[model samples]
Structures are given as C-alpha cells and as structure tokens.
Target: MAGKLQVGLLFGGKSVEHEISLRSARNVYQHLDRSYFNPVLIGITKKGNWHLLEDIDQSIDSAPPLNLSLGHSRHTFPTVDQQGGTGLLDVIFPVLHGTDGEDGSIQGMLQSVNIPFAGSGVLGSSVAMDKLISKQLLKDAGIPTSKFIDLTGQDISKVSYEQIENILGLPFMVKPISLGSSVGISKVSSEQEYLKAIEESLQYDQGLLAEQYISGRELECAILGNTVPRASDPGEIIVSSKYEFYTYDAKYKDPHAVEIKVPAVLDHLIVEQIKDLSLRAYKVLRCEDFARVDLFLKDNQTIYINEINTIPGFTNSSMFPSLWAQHGISYSELITKILHLATERFESKKQLTRDYSGN
Candidate 1:
C-alpha cells in the first residue's frame, strides 16, 4: 500500500477487561480500511506482555500468550509486517481499557517512544481514569457532579464506623478511583455493607471514592476533536432488571440485562443541555482526539456529570462510536476522524519550544 498510514493497534493489558479489549481490537482490526491504513496487530497479553502477532487471523485461532513483563521489555516492540525489514509506526491506536492501559501507563510508554497516539495525553488520561479526580475537576469547572469524598485503602480500613457513615452516608457508591468497566465498584444501601464494599474496592485500587448515589438515567456523549471538539448525540443505558446498578456482567456479558438506547429518550432541550455539558467537560479535562462523557440525569432534570473515559470502549456496542453512528458518522468514518485528529494533535504538540534559547 503506497502512502498508507501504518496504525499500530495496541490492546489487552493487565486489567480485568483484558478479554473485552481483545474482542474490541479484533473487531476494529477487521474493519479498518486496508486502502488507507496498514493495520498492525500488536497484542498485549493479560500478564502485561507485548508481542507482534504475525498473522492476526491465525493468532485468533489460538489463545493469546501472556506477557508478564511488558513494561520491563528491553528491545523496542516491533511493528506489524516487520518480518522483512524494520517497520516504523506512524501512529498508535490504543484500544486498551482499564488499569495499565487507560490509567495513563500505556500513554506514557507511547510518549517515551516518541510515537503519536490516539486519545488524551498522560495528564488527561490519568485524571479522567480516576473517578475522584475527574469529579473534582468537573466541580472546579463549575460543572455539577455527584457529591464525593476521596478515601484511601488505609483510611477506609481505619475509619470508625460512625465516621464512615457520617461522611459517606447511606446509599453510596464505593468505587476504585482508577479502574473502569465497573470493576471493584459496589453500591451500598447501608453501613453494614460499607466495610466489605470498601475491602472489595481496595483490591482494585489504592485510592477509593465514596459518592452519593444520584438516581437518574445513565447518559453518555461522544466527543471528537483536535482543537475544537464536537459532541455526539446522547445515548442512554437501560437496565431490564431492578438491580442495584449497571454491573460488570450487565455491561459486557449479559446482553438482556441492559439495553443501550441511542439518542436517549429525552426532551429536545435536555438533549442539547447534555451534549453541551459533555463538550464542556471534555475541554476542562484537556482530553485530546476523543472521549466519552457519561452523566447522570436526575428525575428533577438536574444533570450531574459522571466520569469521562479518555480511551473508552471501541466495540460496536460501545457508546462512543455508537453515539457518533447515530449522528450519521459511520464506524469507519469515526476511525478516520480519530486518526486525523491524532496526527493533528501530534503536529500541534511539535510546535512547542523544547530547547531553551538564551536572550
């Protein structure tokens, strides 16, 4: 392919959603325009190992090999189609989710290698991945969000029962600050389940957040941009059962457990409001390329910004691409737009003065 952009798709990680990442990557890999992109499948195993998959179709036939020390690897990871000669990566598409992938770890590695990557930078990714910090940033930006208090593992373990109840209150959501895909997240209706929930949450992250559960419809908006960002139509998550909330299984495994309704049922004014707020949150967080802004729309029409996912899920079922699809942007077009934004952002960052010039 002449003049084709070589895209290195990095997926899978040392996270609970590693399997989901594989599914997402494979779907994207197969759909990417071969004419415009030389799609390279760079698989990262669950144990955090990175390997260049020679034949993606054949590799899919076998179980993925685990890479326990991806972070400790010495030689630079080879790009796809490097069998005959060295393959230089033009841009990296990180389709990974949760923990090491979405928590700014992978982004940092890409930065160190001096490779252009899609999505937010280190600060934006790390900030958006942590629920506690994201909420604080939204609040600082004058955006309404659920009431929350940061609690570390040590703090949760040592806090007196009365103190925990007094601060967190009842019917609160205990979440691991840095994890996504609903892992290590629990909703507690009373103090009796507080300790156990906190203990479970600590298994995922050191920092935790106890947030007042704002009852409302779960809404999400997709944002795409280089400098000026555009927000997509809002989508809603509808749960069939009267469960506590959207859990891990309901999100990926159980299809009947939840339904994702695009252009979510809402007043035209409310839809506009949600879309506008989503773009605002994206700018405040300094998210580049793309992001999915999730929010809680209360019955009283009060909109509370939830968290933003810098590297949100990219499968067909994912709200980010799906929302854009509803706005007449097809999946292939969405990918094209994101790649263009990545190049645009990389070029913009190159404009900064790196070497100091003495007057």
Candidate 2:
C-alpha cells in the first residue's frame, strides 16, 4: 500500500437507512482500487457508536456490538504505521445515507475536524436533505418540480382533509421531508389514507411534505465533479405493479420488484433535456463530487425535478453507478473518480484564507 491514498469508508449510522448504507459501503469497499487507495472500514452502530472494523469483510449484522460511549474514542481518524506499512486515511468516502449521515451533520463534523470527504458540502447537504428547502430553492431557480405543501406535526391537527384536497387534489404523496430510500413515504388516495400517512410520516420527521402526484415515469440522472459537473445518461426506475410506488421494500427487500433501464428509452432531444436539467439542479444545490438527481417525466414529455440524493446508494445495482456504467465508467472507476474529486476539492479549499488582515 506504499504511496497509496488511504480512504476511510464511513457507513452505517443511526438512520433508518442504516442497512442500506451497509450494503452500499460493502460494494464501495469491494470495488475500491487497492493498489491506488487503501480502504478503511468505519461502522457507526444503530445506537450512534462509531467503531473501526479490523476486518472489512466482516458482516455488519454479525459484528460484535460496540458498547463504547459516543465521542469517547479520539481515533475516529485512523493512523498509519510507517514502520509496519499500514495505511493511514488521507480522505473519507462516506457511504452513509439519510438523516445524520447525508443531512450535513456528518459533513459539518468532518469540516470541524478538517478532513476531506467526498460529496456535497454542509450547505448543499443540509439544503438537499430538507425537501421543503430544496423544492423552494429549485422553484426559485426556475427548475420545474411538483408542487408541495409543507406541514409540521402541529399543523396537521388544524389542517383539514378538504383543505388539502382543494389545494393539492387527490392521489398526492405524503413523505417525511428529510428522509430518503422512500422511508415513511406513502401515496394517499383517500381521506383516511391521507390522515394515516401524515401521522406515520411524522414519526420519522417533524416536517412533512405533501406533493402533487404527477403520474409519470420515475427518471434519474447521475451528476459528477465540482466546478464543471457532468450528467450521466438518464435512467428509469420500473417498479412492479404490485407495489404502489418505489417503496423501501421495493428498493431493497423485494428482489425483482424493480428494473433499472439505463439510457431510458426516449427521444434524443428529451434525453438531452433531462441531462441538462440534471446538471442545472446539481449546480443550483451547490452539490460537489457526485449526486443522483431524480426526476419525473409526464406523458407530454414535461419534466419535473425530483429531490437530489447527495450520497445515492453505491451498490453496483444502484442507479448512480449504473447510469455512469452506461457512460463507460465501471464501478471501480467511479469510486476512484469520486476519491479524486474529493482530493481536488480539498486542495482547492486549502488555498482559501481563514482570516484577513488590513494591509
């Protein structure tokens, strides 16, 4: 591992998507180029404990529980033994998804520690994690998105079904604003379902977003780089009819529940539009390194931007990598490219001065 950059792969958090993060991290660790990058596995338990795994191949489910208190260990950053030739992490590649992982919490912590990590910075991650903020920003930027109404736990009690129906109409989507992987998201077609969906969503997040449901194809495009970002070929998520939508179960648990079509069957003009919009959204969000921008394509070819996933799933089968793979980037190369982007961004930031003095 001499002369190789050590990459700490951080995953598995106290979020609902913790299991998904484990799967994503496993794929990232397996695909990371050992000759160029030394991968360090760091797992955060469900109870918010961080532990460095001695063996990367160990199953997260079977790994012995870590009883250490939070922030008790100063070794969050792994060190290298020059004499023993063990690699020390030069950068972090967080494969964590949702809540604490993707919501700028971890990004801010890394910033405080002055460590380089891949993906969007704190501002971008925080904004993107909140659907209300992201949708408003996108709307303000003239990016097309489904109309949504923001609601809090207290607002739900005063809000009537008739009021919501008059504003958003039937068959809308009720979701916990900050969560991903379709957790606590439900499609409401009836008054009873609407009430239940809102209550259920509140369990995960205090903020809720009820979006106008646009009946159309679920599309996704992958974005990469910082200053001049590139968008990959758009992909389509084909969910089984059995499922109401791309639920958490559909995305992970149920095999054959979904099919991903890279370079989605569409006119060349439409494809270009999707890519263009994807890049615009990435820039608007101030996203760095890599992200997956989901969109909805209506029957008339009208496109509406869905939320952006700062750290989309990284499994080989995940949409982000699969979309890039269509553009001739293998999973391993994608991981390497992300690492390079992380270093590039870090170096660029290092050039900035923290304090200014009058000359």
Candidate 3:
C-alpha cells in the first residue's frame, strides 16, 4: 500500500438508479486490486448529502443514512479521505448511473476540481444521457437507429396516436429521454396504451422518446480505452416470455428474468460488423475510458444502434464486465485497466496548456 494510488469510489445519488449505483460501487470495490488501489468509499444520500464510509462493501440498505448538513455552498466539491484526512484520492472511479450521476452533473463537478474520473466527460456524458441528442448524433454519423420522435415539454400534449401508428406503427416504445435501467419505459400495443405510456414516461422526464419497435435481439458491446477504443465480444439479452422487454424489475430484482449470451451466435461477418459499429458509435459520442453500446440485431441480419451507457453497471449480472470476461479479461483486470485509463487521461490533460498569452 506504500505506492498504491488512492482511488475514491463514489456511489449513490438522488437519481432513481441510486440503489443500482450502490450495487455497482460494491462490485467494483470488491474486485479492485487492493495491491495497486487504496479504495475509499464516498456515499451520496438520496437527499443529496455527502458522507464518507469506513466500509466499502457494506450494504446500502442496512447502513444508516447520512444526514450531514454540508451547508448551501453549491460550488464546493466533496473531499475524499481514507485515513483521517491524512490521504487524498489520486483518481475517482464513479460507479454512479442516471440523472445527477451519469448526466454530466457529477462529471462537471469533478472537472471543475481538476480531478480525473473514469468514463465520458461533461459534454459526452450529457449528450449520451439524453436519448434524443444521442440518437441525433448517431444519425448524423450515419449510424442506423430506429425511427423516433422527441416529445418535449408541452409537445407531449400534441402527440397524435394515429400519426404515431402511421409512422412508427403499433407496439412502439415510449422512453423517458434521459434515464437508464429502463426506469421509465413502456411498450404500447394499442391506442389506449399509447396515451397511458406517454403519461407514465413523462413523469420521469420532460423529454420523451417514442421509438419504432424493433422486434429483434437485444445486443450489447463493451468498449474500453481512451484514444483508440476497442470493443469486446457482443452479448445478447434473451428475455423471458413473461416480459415484453427488459424492464427495471427484470434487470435488477428478478433472478430468472433474462439470460445473457456472450459473443452472441452470429456469422463471422456480422460479428465483425457489430464490433466495428460499436467502436464507431463510441467515438461518435466522444466517450472515454469505458462504455456499453446497446444495439438491436434484426432477424433479417440488419443491425441498429440503440444507445450508449457511459457508466455501465458493474453489478454481478451486469453485461459490460461479462462481455469483456468472455474476451478473456477478468473482472479485477477490467477494473484495474479502467483506473489506469483514468490516470492516463488525467496526465494527458495536465500536459495541455490551459492559459495562453498571444505571442
């Protein structure tokens, strides 16, 4: 532990995915190579309070809630301490997802403090978090994605069920534009369900996405690196008959909800195409360190890009690590690699000139 880099593992937030973030942070803490990383736990409460934890692997449900009244100084960043203020974190591995955590808010805070964290920067994180923006960027990049329409603010009131059915057809998907883990998603098969789905989805976000249903396989690819990212073997999500799609409950609560197939069975050419598309999507989104790109593989062999998760889950059943595991990279090694990438990116940024005087 003499020369080990101090890493602050930040988790929990005001987002609906707060519990998921806790689970992810625990998995990362458990798998982190202690020999090279002196991990510190920094937990944020649902009420937005920040507190340092002594035990990184402690269950969030059992732990007492943090009630620190850190004042109303919104500009201040939280400090990480491992040994009674005797140490400071060299880098941060934010295992946080959704809203305040994944939507560039936390990333912006980290950047203002000049601290390096894993995953995308503010611009990329914000863009990726918004489904509408991400889809537009992918479309501009010539990536094939499902046809969709964005409903913003009062626009939700102007949506016509008949027009939607005419363009995207029935059984379309209604999603809250900036959420993950399928927190606010609905599949509408009829006109009655269409209105209800939109109403339910708008509760989570003002921006809603009504996308054409792609009746195909759910495939995902994990990408890693800074400059030239590499994609892992693609994985497929086999949903149970009971569920129409991968819902929040099916993802975290239910054990037998879905089965994952790593390196999804496909022709060699299709596999190559998926990997290439995954990397291209990552670059297009300006993602860094790591991300999970979800796509749809149609029965006719055509592939469509879905969306990218800058901070993909690290839960035991998460697909990002599983995909890399299929490619011979162990969970511990993957965590180490991400940490190294954070440091490398930080050092590279430090080398750039921040202030310039015209010569």
Candidate 4:
C-alpha cells in the first residue's frame, strides 16, 4: 500500500440519513478501485462518536446504523488523527448526508486539516442543505421555487392556529429548514394535522420551512464535476401509493413504493431544460464534485427547481449512479471519477495563495 492512496470513506453520521449513509458506504467500499486506492472505513455513530473500523461487516449488528465499538476502530471526533496516529489520509469521501456531514460542518473541519474530500465546500454545502436559504438563493438567481416562509424557533412558538392557517395555508409541506431524506417532513391538510406536523418537525431541526405543495411530477438530474459539470439524463420518481408526497418509507422501505423512470418520459427540449437548470443551480451554489438536483414538472411541463443534494446518494440503487449507468458510466468509473475530482479540488486549493502579510 506504499504508492496506493489511502482513501478515507466516512459515513453513518448523526443525521436521519445515517442508515442510508451506511448502506452507501458499504456499496462504495465493496466496489472502489483496489488497484489505485486503499479505502479505509470510518464510521460515525448516532451519538456523534467517530470510530475507525477494522472489519466493516462486523459493525452491521450495531443498532445505530454503523457502530465503531463493534469494529476494531476506536472512537474519536471528526479529525485525521481520530485513528489515534498521524493523520495519514490521502483523501476523504464523506458519504454522510443531511446535517453535520452535508450541511458544511464536516467540510469546514476537513478544510482546517487540509484534507480533500468529495462534494461541495462549506458555502455550497451549507446553502444547498438549507431548503429556505437555497430557495431564496434560487429565486434570486431567477430559478422558480414554491412559495415559502422561514419559521425560526421564536416564530414557530408564537404563531397561532389561525396565523399558521392564513399564512402558510393548508395542504402545505412542512419540513426542517435544512434537512434531507425527508426526515422531519409532513404534509398538513388541516388544522388537526398542523400542530402535530410542527411538533414532529421540531424533533429534527430548529428552523422550519412551510411551503406551498406543488402538484406535479417529481424529476431529478444528476450533476457531476466542477466548473464544466455534466448532467445525466433526467429520472422521474413516481410514488404508486396514495402518500401525500415522497416520504422516507416511500424512498427506501417499500419495494414498489416508487417507480423511477430513467431517461424520464419527456420531450427532448424539456429534458434539455432540466439538465441546464441542474447545471445552473449547481454552479450558482458553487458545488463541486457532484450533486443531485430535484425538480417538479407541472402538467403543462413547466419546471420548478427543487433542492440540490451536493453529495447525492451513490449506492448502486441510487438514482445518481443509475442515471449515469444508463449513459454508459459504470459504478466503478463513477467512484474513480469522484475520487479524481476530489484530488483535483484539493490540488487547486493547494495552489491558492493563502499567505497574507503586510509587504
């Protein structure tokens, strides 16, 4: 392993997507390039404890996603020396999504240690993870999003039933201001469901985003690379059940919960529009490496840009890889590409002039 790059695969964070992250890490670990890279598994438990895993499979029995205690790896916070030795990581692929991992917290830490990782930087990841802020930024950038309001802890407590009813209106989407995997999301149809929705939402996030639910087809496009990023053919997500929207169970559990139509059923022009919008949104947020941009298409084919996942799911079943596979890129190739992008970004950052002194 002298010349082989020691790649750190970090996953299973203290977010709702913890389990999903574990599944993704397992897939990547089982598929990464053995010739050029030596992938090391770093599992972070739900309590925000970090562990260096010696045997990845042994940790599967732990209840809370991936547990470091189960593996030979000891626990530590987010750092290179968490393995209890010199920080020898050549590159970090943070597979965690949603909160600490996706919201720029981990990015900032990695930056401080000068380690190159996959996905967006602090600014891009932070903005992309926040639904309310991302929506505002998109709106400012001329991208269409549903009408919404940012409800802080103060605002949430003071608002009355009538206030909630009149302002956000009923049959709306309620979710944490910055979360993914549809963790604390709910669809409230009446006053009876409004308070419960808010209560459940508060469990996951401090800020809340209550937006007008758009009735249309759900579409997604995978964006890869930086500066001149490329977009995969659009994919449509159709929930077969009578669920108000695509919830956590619909995305993962039920086998027939949702049908993903690859090369989405749409006109070439509409596909081009979605691909372009995906790129625009990716660039606007200053995202790097990769992202999965979700969109909503109306009956007339009008497109509204939804949120972008800076570090989208990369499991074999994930839409991102699925879309790329349809375009002739294998999963191994995708992983290699992502690793290359990480190195590219790290090298570029190393080239920047960070010395600031009066001369």
Among all candidates shown, the one with the greatest lDDT: 2
Q: lDDT tens string, model 2, 1-359? A: 34988788989998999988988999999999988988877788887767667676675545544332223233234433223333345889989999899999999988766778999989999999999999999999999999888877677777777878888888889999899989999999999998799878988998998899989999999999988899988999999999999999999999899998988999999999999999999999888999999999999999999899999999868899999988899999999999999988998898999898879
Error of 1 at 232 (Å): 0.8
Q: Whole-model lDDT for model 3 versus the true structure? A: 0.86
Pick out the ten consecutive residues of candidate 1 with the lowest summed lDDT.
66-75
Query: Between prediction 2 and prediction 3, which has the larger lDDT?
Result: 2
Residue 242 displacement (Å), model 3: 0.6
Q: Please provide TM-scores, in order, for all candidate models, with all chains considered together.
A: 0.91, 0.92, 0.93, 0.90
Better model by lDDT: candidate 1 vs candidate 2:
2
Task: State the local distance difference test value for candidate 1.
Answer: 0.82
Tens digit of lDDT per residue, candidate 4, span 1-359?
35887888988888888989988898889889899888877888877877667666747324233222222232222333333454366788999988899999999987766678888999999999989889998999998887887777788767666776686666788888988888889988877787898898999889997887888999999988986899998999998756778988898887788988887889999999999998999888888999999999999888998799988887778899999998999888898899999888888877889789978
Query: How are the candidates ranked when ordered by lDDT, highest leading?
Result: 2, 3, 4, 1
Q: In model 3, how large is the Cα lDDT of residue 111? A: 84
Which tens-of-lDDT digit does each residue in 67-95 have in candidate 1?
Answer: 32233233233343323344566788999
What is the TM-score ranking, best to worst?
A: 3, 2, 1, 4
Taking every candidate in turn, the Cα RMSD to the unseen true structure, in Å, is 3.6, 3.5, 3.4, 4.5
Shift in Å, residue 358, candidate 4: 4.0
Q: Please write out the lDDT profile of model 3 over residues 95-196, one tens digit for every residue.
A: 899999999998998887777788899998999999999999999999999999887777766778888889898779999999999987999989889878
Give the C-alpha miss distance for residue 319 in model 4, angstroms. 0.4
In order, the Cα lDDT scores of the candidates are 0.82, 0.87, 0.86, 0.83
Stretches of candidate 3 exceeding 4 Å from the true structure: 57-87
